[model samples]
Target: MFDQDKDTGGLQGKVILITGGTSGLGAQCVLRLALNNASHIYFTGRNTKKGSAIIKETHDAGCTTPLTFVECDLTKLASVKAAADKILSEQHRLDLLMANAGVMNQPPGLTADGYEVQFGTNFLSHALLIQKFLPLMDKTAELPGSDVRIVQLTSTGFRGAPSGGIRFDDLKTVQNFRVLGGMMRYGQSKLAAVLYAQELARRHPNIISVSVTPGIVSTELVSKQNAFHRSTIWLSAKITQGRIYSPKEAPASQLWCAVGPRNEIKQGAFYEPVGILSKITTKYTQDEDLAWRLWDWTQSELKQWLD
Candidate 1:
């Protein structure tokens, strides 16, 4: 199931931008991209020390490639926009934009914008990112046989997430604040992630936009979660029929989405577990209304930055 040309060899000379590349799944993505000999890999994170260290690690891993680290606090919309603008100043083409930076199940926390931390970091931050990079994504195919990619990392808990539907009205969930509520809300955010990708691809036909479940790999994503959540990670590692992958395993599905050769897969399709891209689960795939509504609401929220 591995092709050198489609994934390994072809990755050379591609320019990829990944958010939250300093840790967890994002760190894995950095290593994979470096190994693939990508011409340039630009990633951002808030942890300055860790960010620098990861970049050094990429070079030390024998990438011998250019790695740029932008200090970005995704909690701040202004920061996200400014980072995108910076990239746009120097680069016109962004071959792969993996929205892999997301807060897993977290306790109640607030961002600089005063929005719920999970939704802001996981969904809205990414939404604003796509808006800013929308132009770059559309121009991917202009580079002659170049197919740019946008991969969103969602979760298996998407459908069952949230108390009742993805509440567009109460994204912050000020009315209720239970641990499970937040966890479900986090899933709701992931659900919105694919739905947002769906809406984006529908609007922009030039880019190959997709969402994938990274198959529950062990990473710092658990540390952001509760004890039970952390235990769930351990339990999955122990007893699951499928192999519980490490943080490194997190990026293969991502790199596949970015660089894998697939003959078919309609733009905006949601994929789960590796190169297996399918639009399963009617609860999510069938909800066009929810998707558009989410897009509209998110745009409205980020109107100032968009302006």
Candidate 2:
């Protein structure tokens, strides 16, 4: 039997980057990676106070893993570029890039770049970060036995997206914006994330590019919802058998994707719950044509900023 408590010890000396690492699942991932002795970690968030606290706690626990906090507001593309540039300047290679920062349902709004809130934060910003960091990841992959990886944090909420999938025409929700449409919008963003990972894996066979869902975890994700929405979720959970994982348990799948045996997990696969390979519950997620279309659309969207 595989020892559930055994340490595999793979992250030592690795340089890792995690977005939205200030709290929740991202924070858990940071702790795990640090405990495994990653040489350096660059985590992005807007809260310096919280970031400092996480850093202090890690050091207090006798972890020598150097942690650097980059103040990145994922809602702003400019901030994303600045954070990526800072990492590029300091690190010759990034062994792992976990695009873990995301927001759930929120009142209709636009990002600093005018994209929908959920789509911009959960998908587009992450897409840009991966593009900016690919050169460094590719350089690291050239090393023998190096597991240079890009892990996108997706969710089961993706199953809630529209049947046709990825409303490319109205990603901004300009035509039909509903206050309660946040759930579907969140799902769409996550689906885009999965497709982005699939397309990336196809384009770059040498590196590991995959998305993962942690299942439902009890976290601050629910705190943002209004009272009615929150109550509805609580009631729905009671109606169905919903497994809510703890923060520690939630990050396990992503941690596995980041450092587990490369041969055990396929590139571009959508992994779920405690490190198992599982396809998302949607054919659109695996649609190669749709994946390429998303890729092309994303590239064109980022062209102005990328240039």
Candidate 3:
């Protein structure tokens, strides 16, 4: 275990950003980082009400650190860009960027931009956010003793992805071909996260980029699943009898990645809970060629926004 208690105080004066900070693991991350005394914390979510509640909750907890909520709906690229631009215009340095918001096992659909829903919301939006912030992150890394990190949250569910990792041929479609359509699409999106982190580390050596799994937490992401999918989740839970962490307990690895000593975490690696560098048996996840290809594809897709 990664102990949050021991990790306190290091984040003083650090600037941090998290996605989906209104609830679940994202909310917990906000609380933890605020408690750790981060100088300024910016988190993104669609719910202004919940965002306000989080700020209040943090203040009530006696964490006087400033928390700003950037209204963002990841389904729309334009909204993502607006949020990024706002943050970039305001913040001089970004020490940590946590790509933590995501949907899991969602029904077949497309984003506002016409890509598969999970792919767009989970992977592409975070990609855009990271891309938009790289310059500031680079500047931060140049400062003496600055430790800039980008943490992308992925899942072991990537095992369920299509054999090829990502179905590039039909990313613009719903990807409803197979029996486990939702999971397959979810896995595909998450696999993209892992590959993207790897590519990011290669391209930006100054930043520490890694993907991580929270190890099956119970959150709104689970409760929002449709009836059939919910039952499948229930069945799996019963079979494994696995320990499902609460939001607070689940973000240990992410927090550790965000603030843990720079020498301890490998650049561009995948970690399980509490900073364990997991061995990725899936061959596709280890494919450098596929990682680069996905990077090229993402850049092409987001060319307009990038310009």
* Residue lDDT tens for model 3, 149-188: 9999998889889868998989999988668888999999
TM-score of predicted model 3?
0.96
- The reply for model 2, stretches above 4 Å from the true place, is 1-8, 173-180, 231-242
- All candidates in order of TM-score, best leading: 3, 2, 1
lDDT of 3 at 278: 90
Q: List the residue pairs that clash in candidate 2.
A: none
Give lDDT tens digits, candidate 2, residues 204-287. Answer: 888899999877677888767789877876665555427456777667778778877788878889987667778446888868
How much lDDT does each candidate structure score?
A: 0.78, 0.84, 0.90
lDDT winner between candidates 1 and 2: 2
TM-score for predicted model 2 compared with the true structure: 0.93
RMSD of each: 2.4, 2.1, 1.5
